[model samples]
Every structure is written in C-alpha cells, then in structure tokens.
Target: MELNHMTEKSLIRYDVKETTKEKVIWTLVESLYEQGYITSKDEYFETVLAREKVSATGMEAGLAIPHGKSSAVKKAGFAVARLSNPIDDWESIDPNNKVELVFLLAIPEGEAGSTHLNLLAELSTRLMDKEYYSRLMAAENSEQFIAALDQVSVKEKEDKDTYEKTILAVTACAAGIAHTYMAAEALEQAGKEKGIRVLTEKQGANGLEDEHTATMIQEADAVIFATDISPKGKERFQGLPYIQVRVAEPLGKGDELIDRVLNNPDGIVSAENDTESARGSENQPANKKTGVLAEMGQAILTGISYMIPVIVAAGLMMGIAKLGAVPFGLVNEINDISYATHDNELFVILHHLDKFGFMIFQFMYPIFAAFTAYALADRVGIVSGFIGGLFAAGIHYRFWGIEEGIPSGFFGALILGLSAGYIARFLNQKIKLNKNFQAMKPMLIIPAISVLSIFLLNFYIVDPVFGGLNVLLRNTIEASQESGEIVLSTIIAAATAFDLGGPINKAAGAIAIGLAADEIFPLTARVLAIVIPPIGLGLATVLDKYVVGRRVFDANLRVTGNTSILLGFIAISEGAIPFMLRNPIITIPINIIGAILGAVTAVLLGAVQWLPLPAFWGWPLVENIWAYLIGLLVGTLFIALANIFIRHMLIKRGRMTITS
Candidate 1:
C-alpha cells in the first residue's frame, strides 16, 4: 500500500469542537467507523485507550497520534482532526505543550506490525517538518488538508556537490516510540536545508526501519548517535567518527549538530574514544569536582529502574497466589511454606505459581548487576556483571576453599557488578586485537576473561571482605534492634521515606529484604515505610479540601492523589514521587516523620511481616492485622495534618496560592 493511501480526504476534519480527550477520540473513531475503516467503534476505542495507558502518543510538537490495531478495524487508515481548542494533559514531553492536531489511526490486527508501522512512521517523520506542520495547521478545508499531507515526503532538497559530505544518523530512545522518529525527521530536514545528504536509521518501538547499510556507513562523512540507551550493534560504528548526544537533542538542535559536523570535522570523536571517555568519567573519584558521584548515582538508578518491575510483578503474583491458597488452608501465613507438602491440585497450582514468582525474584540481583554494568561499560559489562551478581547471591565454590555460600544480597551485587563492569571496560581498552579477531573479543574473549576474573575476585577477595562487612552491617542493625527496636524501626522508616524510590530509600528497602530473607520477620519495617508515604499524601489531599475549608489542591493533584492512594494500598511508594518532587521541603519532612511514627508504632504493637512484600492486600499475612491498620491510620493522619499546616502557613505568608 502507498504510505499516504490512508490519508484520504473523507478522513479529514477541520476546526473540531471536541474539548476533552474522550470526546476527541470518539469523534475521530466515529469518522473512521462511518467510512467503514472500522467494524466496531467501541472495540477500536477501547484499544486506543489501552495504547494510551502504555505511553502517551503525544509528540513534542502540538500533535497527538492516538492509534490502535485491533480485529475491530476492517482496514488500515487514519482520521485527522484539527481541534478548535487544545487539549491539556495530553502527555506531551513538554508539560506546557498541548495537542492541537490529532491523527487517530485504525489498523487491522494483521496489518499492525507491517503497513500500520510504515504509515505511522511516515506521519511521525513528516510532522517534524516545520513547513509541513504549519501547512497542516493553516489548511482551511479537507482538500487543503489532503494536499498538505500529500506534500509530506522524506526526501530533502538535493545538492549533488555536497553528496560526498553525506551524514548517516541513528536515533533511539528508551521507549523508542516518538523521540526516535522525531530525531530522525529533524536530522533529515536539517541536512536538506544545510545542503548535506542525510540517511537516518530509526531504532524504534516498531523495530529498526530504514536501516543504513554497511556501504552507506562507509560512504558517510560523519555519523550521529542520538540515543539515551546504548544503541544496538554499536560495534558497527566503532571505527567511524561520530557525535553522540541524547535522543531529545535533535528535536530543537538538529541543524546545529549537522553544522558542527560539517564545519569542524576534526572535532568528531571516534566511537571507541567516546566509549572510553564515558568510562573514564564514570571511574572518576567521588571527591572529584566533576560529578562522578552523579554518574554512579545514575548507574544505581538504572539498576533500580530494572529491579522495580521484577519486584512489583513478583510481589503481586505472590500476593494473589497467597489469596488463592488462603481458602485452601495450604498457606495459612507468610512464613516459608513448601509447595511439596501440598497435594490438592488447586493449592498445588497456586503454590507453584508463588514459587515461580520467587524464582523470578532470583534473577533480580543478576539483572540489577547486568544492567548496572551495562550502564557503565555497555554490552560487555552485561555478561560479566550478571555472572558477578550470581556469585554475590550465594553461589558457592568449594574448590576455592569456599565451603559455605555468602549471602551478599543487593549491596554485594552493586559492588561486584561495578567491579565487573570496570574490569571488562579496562580489558576492552588494554587488549587490542586485529579486525578479524575483534568480533571474538566481545563475544568470546571479554566474557570468558571478565567472568573468570570477577568470579575469582568475588570469591577470593570481595567475598571475604565485603561479605564480612555485610554480616557486620546486618549484625549492627540486629544489635540496635535488640537494644531499641522502635528506634531502629523509626530510623529505617525515615530513610525509606526520605527519597521515595531514590538511593536512600532503596538502601533501607535492601536492608529490610535482606533481613527478611535471613528469616527476621519483625524487622521488616521497610514494608510499612513503603506504604505510608503515598497513603499519607493521598490523605492530605482529601483533608486539604475538607478540613482546610477550600480546595487547596489543583484538579491534576486531586486525580494524582486518588491514584496514589490506590497504588499506596498496594505498596507502590514510587506513586508519591511526583508530589514529593513538587514540594520537597514540605512533603519530604512530613513523609519521613509520618513513616517513622508508623514504623515505630507497628513495631511497638508487635506487627510482623514474614514476606518481603508490602501491600494492603497482604494484610491477612500480617501477624497482627489490627496493628498494621492502626499504624497506617496514624501515619496518614499525621502526614495529612502536617501537610495542611505547611500549606496554610505558606498561603498566609503569601508564598502559595489556593487553586479554587
């Protein structure tokens, strides 16, 4: 099918009056349904909503592409709408940017991965052209709209003289959805305007499209690597001179990057050198004025980013499995229960599912290590770091005089993973191989050498040193608990709530989970700490409106509050991060204080959680459910009152404003 075949005049709507997102979506979907492109409007609409929930399709420009592929779609097509008024909260990268132009796509399930992607890609790239976007916005009628869209093309103005100075670019982002294509389009457009030929490969959500060939890479004068994450097949550009920047950089400064490559060709760094420089920066001492600590902080954040999903998924699965097994009496409490003891089919299934979830949890440390290494030293670090993490997590080597496995946990994983990554990076730099053997260096040589080295180091050096340190730390905490249980609980709770999901919070959580894994049930204060912040902020939202005698919060804040409360009940502390970020001075102190109070109260009341999981749904698993509830209630009230007081003070001092 032609790329522009879906852009029919019949699908175009000018000066639309729809205000809300739902109305806008319905109006566009109705147009497609009327035109027979869709068989079931409701099904198509629901599919589009589901897509929205994944990530907003809104572009950096004032355009939103809400699309779906479903069996309800009879044909692959698009409906265009130019709204009379912009829609707020459309999930644009720029929070202030609103959606004025909408492209609603309906694709048959069979065509979604093929023709649909091509058409979507074409539209996304075309939308980046300033002239094209302006024409679409100015078009007065359906014919004009179709004309403007038909004018959209990927080819830029040709200049044969500058063909030899051709630039090849690859664009990618973590999501690999909008920014990837947007960057590609921007570079293409900028190259055209600057009289330079540009070929772009977009490594996007739909997978690599319009990939540059080896011949094209060799012919190119310069290369651009615009990606947040490390690009796939980065070795392809190893010898090439390139400029690397964040994927979002090209959106506004594509022309500048292109000009820089053209004007100062010598300034372009080789891909290998760029990688080494990045590694060097990461390895810089924390005491250095340069933000080496920030780089380390980023690596830790990357590890946490990968770890959270595993924990959430496993926690939910185990919780649901426990809920199912509760009725069967196969699992009465959260203490370690063996599925082997259960004989009933239903109970066995539930028990095994929970066990399967824990099995997934086993990879958490390995994944954390691998990605952390990957963040530091690219792909080579991944294999080495993973092996290092496996060793950290109770992997025994008897021949090396290690009869007993040391449970190093997340802390040990962090140290070993970082070491493995640096060692792999160092090896890559020090060991030089011919071009023919370079391929084996990454695949065979790096992994074999780095893994062995990390294993030996971890087993002989790190295991004994850090392992003993880990034991000492745990013993110190245990000692504090014995002398002053409430004090220790309060401190742990405060640290967990201090940063929401940041390093401090993760540190506290790791300690709690580590203790729980060691069969210390009552010491799991991290569970209450995780749930308290979100619940407290959510309660504060409601109290601000009722007790404060006015709606002190905005509509968005109220909606966020509702979502936070729901997620908080399920033990998702990250849900409260947005609120904390908005008013850190007030929110942080209130959250920390409230969490400490709740944790202390829970510990004092003999509330104990055997499992590492924390959620209201797991209340039945708590040794004292009443105490758990009481702790939560007390914390929520304390946070609510404190928040109200702070906001009232700020308002009285003329530093804050009431929304309504």
Candidate 2:
C-alpha cells in the first residue's frame, strides 16, 4: 500500500481533548477499530503498549509515533491525533518536550515486514520535514490535516555522479531509531545543497536500510561515520579515510561535516587509527570525557543485556527439567541427581538438562567481564577481562596460613571487568611504543601486563577481602536460618526487592544461588523474595482499579502490570521496573515491604527450595508449597492495599489529580 492510502480523513482527529498519553492512544485505537482497520481493539492496544515498554516512540518536535503490528489489525492504517495539551513525561528523545502530535499505526501481523515498514519509512521521512510538521500542527480540522500530509513530497533517491566528490556515511545510535534516520536525512539534504553525491546507510531499529555496497564505498572519496555505537562491518571501510563523530553531530551539522571532508582531506581520520582516540578526541567539546564514560557505561550495559538471555533461557530450562523429574523422585533433595550415569531414562534426561543449564550459568561471569572490557579497550581487553573474571570466580589464595577460594560472583566480575578495561586503556594511552612495535602493544604488551596485574591484584588483595566477606555473609544467613530469625530474612527480602534487579537485588540473588549450589536449601527465603515484588506490584495495579473506584493505573500500565505478574511467575523480577519507574516513591517501599513479609512468612512456615530457580512452576519442588502460596497471597494483598492507600493519600493532598 502507498503512504497516501495508509492515511485518511476518517483517521485524522484534530484538537483531541485527551489529557493523558494512554487516553490519547486509546482514543485513536478506538477510531481505528470503529473504522474496521483493526479486528480487535484490546489486542491491538496491548501490542502497542508492549512496544512502548521496550522503548518510547516519542521523537523530537513534539511528535510521537506509537505503532504496533498485530494479528488484531485487519489491514495497514494510520490514525493521527493532535492533542489539545501535550502529555508530560511521555518518554520523548528530549524528556523536557512533551508530545502533542501522535500518529498511531495499526498493521496486520502478516503485513509488518512489507507494507508496514514501507509506510513507517515514508511517514518518518515526512515527519522529519519542518514544513510538513508545521503544516500538520497548524491544521484546524481533519480535512486540513489530510491536505497538509498530502502536500509532503516523497523523497526520491539522488543519482550518483562519478565526476563529483562522492561520500558514503553510516549513521547509528544506541536505540537506532530516531537519531539514526535523522542523521541520514540531514547528511543527504546537506549533500544535495553542496553539489556532492552522498549515500547514507541508516542502522536503525528495523536493522540496516539503504546499505552502501562495496562498490559505493570504494568509489567514495571519504566516509563519515556518525554513531554512538561502534559501526557494524567497520572493516569494509578499512583502507578509506573517515571522520567519526557522535550520531547527533550529523543531525545538526551535516553540511559542515561534508565541507570538512571536501575542503580539508587531511581532516579525515583513517579507519586504521585508534578508534577510542577518534571517538574521545581532545579537540572535541568539553563533554568528550563524559561521552567516554557514557560509552564505558553502555559497554557494561551491553554485557548485561547479552547475559540476560542466557540467564532466562537456562533458568527456565532448569525449572522445566526439575518439573519433569518430580515423578522420578530425582531432584527431591539438594544435589540428588548425580553427574554420573543414571539408570532411569527420565531422570537421566532431566539431569543432563539441569547440567546444561548450570554449564551456561558458568559462562555468565566470563562473558560479563569480557564484554565490559571489550567496551572499554575494544578487542585488546577481552583476554585480560576474561582472565580477571576467572580469577574473581575461582582464584584460591593463602594469607597468614589461611586458605580460601574467592567466590566474588557478579559483583566481583563487574569490578574485575572495569579494572581490566581501564588497565588496558591506561597501557594503550600512557605507554609510548615505537611505530614499528605498535602491533605488539595490543598483541603482547597490553594483554600480558593487564592479565598479570589483574591476577596478582585479585589473588593478593581483592580476593581475600571479598572472599572473607562472602564467607561471613553466607555464615550469617545460615545462622539466621538455623535460629529461625525472620528479621534477617525480612532484611534480605527487602534488599532483593528494593531496586528490583539492580545491584542490591542481584547481590542477594547471587548469594542465594551460590548457597543453593552448595546444597544449602534453607535459603529459599531469597528465592521466594525474588518473585514477590513483581507479583505484588502487578496485584496492586489490578486491585487499585477495583478498590479505588477510579482508574489510578493507566490502560497501558495496567497491561504492563499483568505482564509483570506473568514474568513474576517465571521468577523474573525486572518486570516490575516499569512500574517502579512510574511511581518509585510509593511503588518501591510497597514492593520492599511485600517481599519482606512474604519471605519472613515463608521462612516461618519452613518453606525450602532445593533448586535455584524461583517460579510458581517450581512450587511443587519446594517444601511446604501451601505455606509458600499463603505467604505469596498475603504479601500480594498487603502490597495492593498499600498502593491503594498511597494513591488515596496523594489524591487527598492534591498531589495527584485523577480524572476518573
């Protein structure tokens, strides 16, 4: 379908009275449903809300495009709504700027790859034009709005001239959505005005689009790479002269960048040059160092992002394996299934699956450390970081006749990764090697020094200290469990739920998983604690709607909350993050309190989980399953009541204004 055919007068609503983003989205979705564009309103709306949770669709210039490709959509269509007042904190690229113009897209699941993407590309291009945006904003009615959209000219590809100085550019950002495309457009527009042929590849959410061929790269005089991330397939431009800058640079100063390449050829940095120096150049703005730090942080996040899939997949597999082993009486006790050959077929299969899960978990530390270091010092830091992680996880040291192997877990891996990365960076920056021996810096010199230094530091200093702390922590938790001290359990539970999968929560989880591995099954309080916060918060969202006599939770958020409960059932605590982000003041405390109560109650009832995984599916494996259920139910109710009370207080104090 054409872009013009996607939009219609019936789909455009000017001067909408909706005060909230949820209300605005639902209004447009309802319009689409009424016009027979969607097969089911609820299904389409839920899909859109799920997409929003991944990342906000709000772009710059007071515009938001919230689209979803779902089975509920009958055909591809677009609905535009101009809000009377902009929605605050609508997760825009610029957080301070609210969204006024919203284009809600509905496309059938089958059409997502072909027609949906084409319409999105066309719409995104039109929205980027200032005149088109201005025309849409000024339109008083649906007819005028349609007319304004009709005036937008579809962008046509510029023919390449071999005689002209042609440049190929790649643009990308962390999200790879708005900034990536905008930079591409700016560069293309700037190239057109300057009589230079510019070919841009946008690496975005939908993956690479309009990719430049090898012939195009070889033909170009210079390459410009504007990206927050390291450009994918960077080696393809190895011999070319290139200028690298932040993705935002091309969006505003594309013309200036093109002139720099055309006027001063030497100004272009070679792709072979040190990428770190190119990205964190001293000649750039004052925030260059800050940008460097942000990049480092992004690297750590990238490692965690990769690690999460392994955790989820392996954790769930182990959980399922344990369920299958129930009838065979395998996994009835801690470490009941031996690694040796088993006689029973079902038991053997489940045992191997459990072993497989553990095998995957074993790589978690090394992967985290490697990627963290990779982010800081690129390829040079990988070996050193991996070594550092191994040292953190398994190094044994003797100090004053006392011998102990440090089990630093995730936190230790994090520190080691950072240390290895920075050490590699320092060696790269400070050590002045001759031009002839520069290759040795990465191959031999850097890795050798980094690995040796990290190993020594972790063994002599870091390990002993953290290892001793680890022992003390485990002993304390064991002692608490022995004494049936609910207070200690409460504290652990509270800490686990406080940040909802942050450092504190992960620390508690790591300790529990470690203890479980060692056959210390009494620490099921931590396992129970992990599932409480998300389930409780989700329950609160449902209860708030029915108990408060008003819709305190937004429609999108309500759907997200239900998803959180489902995730909670599978022992994923991060599902509560969206709710926590919305109202941390109330949500966090309630979550902590609920988790504490649940854990304490479970402890008092002698609930025990032999396996490390926490989920309702794994409930049958736990001792006193009924008591665990009771604790969960009670905690959920407490969290729900707490949420209702807080909202009522906020409304009474005029802090929150409820429309319904």
Candidate 3:
C-alpha cells in the first residue's frame, strides 16, 4: 500500500488549540463524532483509551497516533492536530517536546479490526521522512500539507526490479517510531540522490509488518536492518547480503555503507574500508551494552501496559456489581421486604455487569501474550500471538481438568508464538512463488500456511507435553497441600519474586489455579493466595520507602500495592509485579517471607473461605475476615521489615548504592 492511496482528500484541520492531553483526545473524539466520522463519543473515547493503555499509541518525534475502533464510529476518518500544549503519559519519551501533532483515527467498530494496524505501519513508515514530516509541520495551513503528501508517490509498485538491484535502507535509533522512519527517509533520499531505484522498509517500536516480497527481494542485491530491533520476516532476505548496524551509524556514514552495498570501486564499507568499519567498531562497545537497567525499564513499563486493560475491565465490572448489591447487613431485611422480589433491578444490573467483566477477563491472557509477543516481534506478531495465547489457554484448561478449566498462562502463549513465527519465517524462506500468486501473499497465503503449521505442531508437540505437565502439576499441588499452605505459599512467593512477571511467576500461579480446581481450598482461599504477594510488597514499600527508593516509588504504586493486597485477599500473586521491579533482591525475599507468614497466619486464625476466584477485590474472600486482615497486615509488615534489613545491610557494606 502506498501513501497516496491511503491519503484521502478528506477535510483536515491544523493548528488546533488542544493544549492538554485529555482535550486533544476529547477534541478529536467529539469532532469525529459530530462530523459523522464517529457515532458516539463515549464508545470512541473508550476504544482510544483502551489502545492508549495498551502501549501509548505515541509515535516517535513528538507524534502520537491515537486511533481506535468503536461502535460509536460512523466512518473512517483522520483528524490531524498540533497540540498547543502537552500532558504527561508514560510513552512520551521527550517531555520537553510534548506532542506537536496528534493523528486521531476513528473507524467504525465493524472496520476496526487488524486492518488499521496495517494502515498504521504504512503511515509510520512514510512519516519517517524528515523532509516529509518537516513539510507537514511547517505548513501554515492544511492545503499545503496535504499537497506535499500528495506529491509523494504513495503507489506501491509490483515490478521486482523497481526495488531490487540497488539498496534502499531505513535505520532508526530505537527501532521505535521517529528514528526508524527518519532512517528510512534518509536511506530513500540517499538512494534517489545516487539514482538507485530503491524501496526501504521500516523497523519501529510497532515492529515490521509490510515488506518487499519474493520477486523484489530476490532481485535485490542486498538488504539492511538498520535498527536495534530484531528484523521480523528475516527469511525474506535469507540469501541477500544484509548489513546490520545502529541507525546512528548509517546517519553518520551512509555514503560508506551505501558504497559497499553497491560495489564501491573505491573503498567504502568494503574490504579496503575495513579500517573505517574498525574505527566504527571502536564505538561498538558503547552501543552494544544498551544496559540491563534500560531493558528492565522497558520490560516493566510493558508489563504495566499489559496489565491495565485487565484491571480496568475487572474494576469497573466489580464496581458495578458492588453498586448493584444491598449492604451485607441489610440483605436479610431486603430479602423479607415486599417489593424486594419485584424490584431486583439493581441486583440484576450488577449481575450483568459482573458477567460482562468476567467475559473481558477471559481475554486477559490472550491480550498479555499478544502484546508481549508484539513487544518482541512487532505488528506481524499480534494476531498470531493472540491466537497462540488462545491455544495455550485451551491446552491449559484441558490439562488442568478444572471444572471450568485452566486459562493458558503467558508461557503457553509464547510457545504458540514461537511455533507460528518460526514456521511463518520458514515458509517465507523456502517457498517460491511466481508473480501470479503475489497478490495472495498477505491476504491468504502467509496466514493460512502459518496457522496450519502452528495448529499441526501444537497438536503433536504441545498436546503431549501438556498431558505430562498436567499429571505432574496435579500431584504436586495435592502433595503440597497435604504438606500444607505454608509450604505452598513459600513456593509461590519465591516464584512470584523470581523474574518479576516471567515464566516462573506464571508457573506458580498456574499451580495455585490448579489447587483451586481440585477443591483443595474454597474459592476464597485461592483468592487470598493470589493477592498476597503484591500486598506484601506494597506494604514493604510503604513501610520502608528508602529500600524501594523514592525515585521509583510513586503515588500509583501505593494504589497498586493496596490493590495487590485486595487481590491477595482473593489469592492472586500477579499483583506484586510493580513492587517486585523496584528492588528485586529485597522485594522478592520480602514477598516470599510474607507469603509464608500469611499462609501460616491464615491457617492459625482458621480463616477458611474456599473459592478459587480471587475474592471480588478482597472483601469477602475470607470467612474470618478479621483474621484474614490481621494475617495480611502482619505478613505485609514482616516482609517490609525484612526488606529494610536487607537494604540496610547492603548499604552498610557498599554493595548497593542508595542513589543508583
């Protein structure tokens, strides 16, 4: 797809006075709704907000693409606005620049599927052109801006030679948004300047989706992945000579790299230019160590991003349910009232709300796995990854034999992802197609082959492994319960602390879920276990802020921490992620200690509410509610003290730095 084809001659306005983030969103939302582009403001706002919560649709270079599919949308339309002011959001890397421009997209819910993702990929790639973006930015009015984009050839061509025989490349700094597209623009202009027919592909935070296919790739002399991101669909360039380098390197030494790829008779990026490459290599040491801290920061942010939708849906659902019900003390009185049977509207509404929330919760695993996979692989991974997650969840249910069954953990989704991804790449690499079949590639061929392989592979491989895992998991849960909740909590807390939110945590939680399935404890007990870790960590952070550090500590953490306890009262260990990331060493141990303590206390206090489901936000999960609260509180404080002691010891020894 070309920019021209996608760029419609719709009414677009510029220099709008939307200073705040909410204003920008609401302005576009309301505008779209009023203009028949959208049907309702509420639905569109929610859809956009949901996407934002997913990963900040914020693009690089002070741009944010906030687009969504909603029942409120009446038509597909794009509204471009330049923000007079900016507001804070996690995805905004440069707070100084704010969002100079916002691309608000509204599409009818019917059209809001994955199709927009492809459009996003195209727009992102094109906007990479600094010259292009500059034109858009510099335009005094909408007409000039539209005209400039109109001038660019958006028509994607099919001729293989048009893209091959000479190199076109895009190198972005973070393989995110701004720099990725900028690099592509740089490479394109450079190629055009050198009179080379070239097509450049972008590698951004969103990942690679569109690419030059078989004929074009086959005819190409070479290719380049000029970003830090992993090159998706790598098999497309299997035999082509490919150069991988940082985007900055290309920006600094484009001429040299280009010369080498195009057979520089002189010496640039050539064997003769080995010294140049060596000197470039001197800077390599600095570039390669992107740093664990940076990676961790991104991972934590990503995890938080994944968790939002689930929490929002769950919270709203539960809130509605709560609002619908009568006060516990008044329930008996209400039940005996004459009008009670006839007027259960509130109760009925609450039930429906709860049911709706539960349905959304079912999608949580799939969303988590899909987003994680997307974070790993980009746009190409979303659908496949989501499907993979569904498969994993299915497998989990069958294996666990839960009366309702186990929802697949994130790990299972990952397995499905790896299978689908590699298989897709393999097919792309090995299969040869003529021009006649080219049109079928994206629409049918790739997805068809990829899903088929994933299904077949899972059938043979994942199925059996799941069977073995089920037996082992069931027996272990039974044995552990026999040994008791103290042993179980210790194991879970350890797993929860390990790797923050990785496979280990998933495994432990799966075990808890498994135990719940077997009637080992009532639903309430399971709920308590699930939520304790976060509460413990949160309590520790509150009591000993120095250990967790004020730098990382924020008001939200407090809320999250409390929520974890709420979740813990119901027994969901995943609540501890935020606290765990702050100081893993102190946090993990604290969680482990707290889990054990909580378990012991619960048993001693004879708090016995048995429902596997997380206590609906912690209130009713415990039968002996006071004992449950005491256990949670005591366990939390104990863990906090443990964390403080560890931090103090580390500081005294100079093994850790308070400021660092």
Q: Which candidate should be chosen as best, given lDDT against the real structure?
A: 1
lDDT of 2 by residue, 425-482 (tens): 7787667666677678888989899999888877777767765655565565555645
Q: What is the C-alpha lDDT of each candidate?
A: 0.70, 0.69, 0.54
After TM-score superposition, what is the CA distance of residue 342 in candidate 1 from its true location, in Å? 5.0
Ranking by lDDT: 1, 2, 3
Query: Where's the lowest-lDDT run of ten residues in candidate 3?
Result: 266-275
- Once model 3 is optimally superposed onto the true structure by TM-score, how far is the C-alpha of residue 206 displaced, in angstroms? 16
Q: What does candidate 1's lDDT look like per residue over 1-660, in tens digits? A: 244577677778886898888799999999998999987666577667755654456765688877765656777778988888988878764566689889887756434247666766667677787777888888898887777776754554565576557888889754454567888988987877777888889886567778888888777788887776556666676555566766766776788888755554323343333333333443321222235554565565566556546655655566567667656554434324655466656666777777876676666677778887877777778998997767655554543576544556555677888888778878777776776676787888889999998878876787677556545545555566555667778767887787665445655666777766877545447888888898888777787746654444544456567756766876666556546534666788999999988878877888888786576656778888888878878888898788887886675454554321
Cα lDDT over the full model 3: 0.54
* Structural similarity to truth (TM-score) of each candidate: 0.54, 0.67, 0.49
TM-score quality measure for candidate 1:
0.54
**lDDT (0-100) at residue 225 of candidate 2?**
80
The numbered model that scores best in TM-score is 2
Arranged by TM-score with the best first, the candidates are 2, 1, 3
